[model samples]
Target: MSHPPAPPTSPHPRRWLTSRARVGLVLAVPLLGLVNQFLGFFVLVLAIVLIWKDNPWEKAAKVVATIAATALLGAVVPDPQGKDAGGTVARADGKGTAHGRAVDAVTSASPSPSPTVKPGPRAADYRGLRLDRAREKAEAAGFGVGDHNASDDGKSIWMRSNWTVCFQKTGWTWSDTKTIDFGAVQTGAPCPEEDGGAVPWPKMPDLVWKTWKTARKEVVDLGVPADHVLADTAYVNDTLPDEGDYDDWRVCVTDPSADSDVTLDAWVTLGLTDPRNGCPKSDREDGDRPSLPDRDDDGDPDYHDPFPGDRNRDSAFPNGLPRGSDGSGGSSGDDDWDWNCPHTRWC
Candidate 1:
């Protein structure tokens, strides 16, 4: 008790850095910022504490040394830019970084840099967007799209706006990662089951035995023109008396006939026959000859043949062609061509 509290064996400032320097010790944590400006807030706070602390140079050194001993260490020097941004360099999103703060602490005489960093979208995000828009987006993200866009159905995409994205692929390595691929297809068309597949085209339907009206509708539905569909048989087809019910008649033969793939504008001709009597067995009528000989013995019957005298070339002419076009028939136009082009192709 005599010793009382003998001053707790007090040591000099050189011996013990005491509570007086505790603030420096704590501030040192942020001053050694190494990662990015990630601890930007901490750095700012450290700078602020320096304003009230004594011997800032001494405190700064202590912090640098402390950090140098830890994992966070790199080329961080005092940046005059820090002073301009109000001694704050790190962003709330952590972009300002611990390094920025450390630099500010070292020599915060200049304004801090406020760089604008906007992140881009990921590769997967490009899917489902319009093809044109997807390319624009990829470019915005710092990726260049020269001519990489292609159709999933293998159809040429002349107008990008008319299609939409369905899938994506990236480049082989990270260096070429921006070389992104987008699989697309026309807006209303379904995506192909596999890339580079062709879309199926519409085909002509079987119309034999069906009423002329039903056959006509089916042809029209297949995209054939209404005016292009004509009655196959002549006897009952000439001109209906309205009450005659021409639509009730059945089709015996078709032009581009049955099951043939056809385009929308292709002309469709249907041979008409009395439903009760049925299709003609032959050009001879009454019974088919297994081969319909030219009724005129000169060329194909004028009946439903689009190219009446051109032999088996059914689609060569839309209007009736001159008979014996090869100069075989005694005359032209309506003359018989059977002299040269004989029965062929059709049953």
Candidate 2:
């Protein structure tokens, strides 16, 4: 009599894992170095399969035996003595090694610093739904409004004072990383090359122009009358080169003639730039290059008091121009300061 065919073999535990699970395991192999949770899960799953295939009650014995064997082996290993103990102790006491490894990992994984983005004529680069509306809001908030630049797309607006805002657009958002005060500006370096050689970033001139316009407008609107507004168009080797960083520009609202009827005296300096370039040229005559002046004409080095204490000279002097007038409203000396008395000149 032909014996009944042996029952078909049951699927192997390893083979029983789904193709998806197998793929998952393969992909997980690389992550084992950094992620311990997945590693432990993989090992657990493997152990379960092995235990299931063993003799029914054999799993319990296997686990107990493994524990007892480990303990016995550990005890037989002998208490390391002298030189052997010294090596083990050294490893345990190596605090510096642990710290160093942590630091190395952090340094290797850290992201590089990103370049700054400046406010400009772009409407899409700014905040608020309407460009003009946003400008109005900023002006109402004591901020000077200026021209804007939008990306090739009209979903954002870049304005003066290192301000950039995004318009409502799907999947678009922004966070104000920082606020810049225009009063404490320092001369900056010129914008650096973006991709290769010479000509500064193309976007710089726009920034410089926008910032100057804002500051100028604020001063005028605030009731300070300016006789002349001169903007540098030369790209000379300057002391305060444009840094092209997003810090705000230094804002100075002063009257050269020391004769205005305003109350506030505002002076602020801040960085402003795009990751690409430095300031924009206010006077478009130079064709995008910054015209660094030979002398500081902004009343910097010469006059001790560049501007009147208050917008109105009346409040500052009370009685028609106080006596000594060496230009600093103090006693006169032999300095050529008297020659330029009352006349503001750029350093």
Candidate 3:
């Protein structure tokens, strides 16, 4: 019976733990002293001496001397900026090459700044170009042919090299004394009323009795220039005819005369004639032949003498009626005669 009492002598050789191993050694020693800080502070002082065995060893040695004086006062202080264990930051001349420049000056990482651009203004596109190359590309882009505005759908604005642009003003951000406009058209002239439908100009017709190769093909179909249609010979009598035959000549005098209006390609002249001298009369003809002199005693000549100075009134000679100077049917100064045929037909 005294042997069974021997089992009660147990002061602490490690065996009586269970209350769930004293709450699993008081939560596994501060989670194993946050993983390995010296093997979790030597397994947190051996699990606080087996979870304070039966307590009082002077309150379990003052709870393991207050967790070893708070892990020896956080390992004797010192981290001003000397961080280590790979959190880098060491140098105050404690060279590891100033610990990579003190971890490139405190665990490194700064680079941000960048942004600045500017440059606009300078234009000259000139649409279909050619008003003298759109004024040489708007005066070589520095603008100023008094800036610009050309505009000329015909009526010859100095025929700007026979024109072309068609309409311009384009995008324009311009500024070297800005100004633009452009419009143009004539090279074969037309498009202008805001570029839609214009082509009219040609008119100048009646090239007189025609033929200097039909008046130079009607003045080169009005765009003018069968050498600006000049011609000039016109001699009904002199006889100088060795070889001049432009279809035997004919356009008798036309310096803008026949139905006049003018201007398209301008410069006319003509005067040809010599159709063996037949049609050249025009000082506005039609008096029916009376180069003057027949005061009308009725020979029917003062331009067919209607009552030319009335020789007893032949009234244009009705079937043989000329009896003047008192031959009986009535004559002698026929009641004081004074007719003067067709307004004194060049009397």
Q: Cα lDDT of all candidates, in order? A: 0.56, 0.35, 0.54
Off by over 4 Å in 3: 1-132, 139-163, 171-193, 210-223, 226-249, 252-347
Off by over 4 Å in 1: 1-156, 160-192, 219-245, 262-269, 274-277, 281-347
Error of 2 at 256 (Å): 25
**Which digits, one per residue and each the tens of the lDDT, describe model 3 over residues 1-347?**
45544455665545434435654655554555555456556655665665566544467665665576346534543343424534344455644354433243343444445564333334556656568878777777765542222333334457566667766553334333554556676565544455444545556677667677777777777667666767765542222234445565777667777665455557887766556454545665664422224575444434335666766555434433434433344436545322432222334
Candidate 1 lDDT by residue in tens digits, 38-90: 46445545544544355434667656544542322223433444353345344
Q: Which stretches of candidate 2 lie over 4 Å from their true place?
A: 1-44, 52-54, 57-60, 64-347
The candidates, ranked best first by TM-score, are 1, 3, 2
What C-alpha lDDT, on a 0 to 100 scale, does residue 68 get in candidate 3?
Answer: 62
What TM-score does each of the candidates earn?
A: 0.33, 0.17, 0.23
Worst window of 10 by summed lDDT in candidate 2: 180-189
Candidate 1, residue 293: lDDT: 35
Considering lDDT, which of the candidate structures 1 and 2 is the better prediction for this target? 1
Query: What's the alpha carbon RMSD for model 1?
Result: 19.6
Error of 3 at 230 (Å): 7.9
Q: Which of the numbered candidates is closest to the native, going by highest TM-score?
A: 1
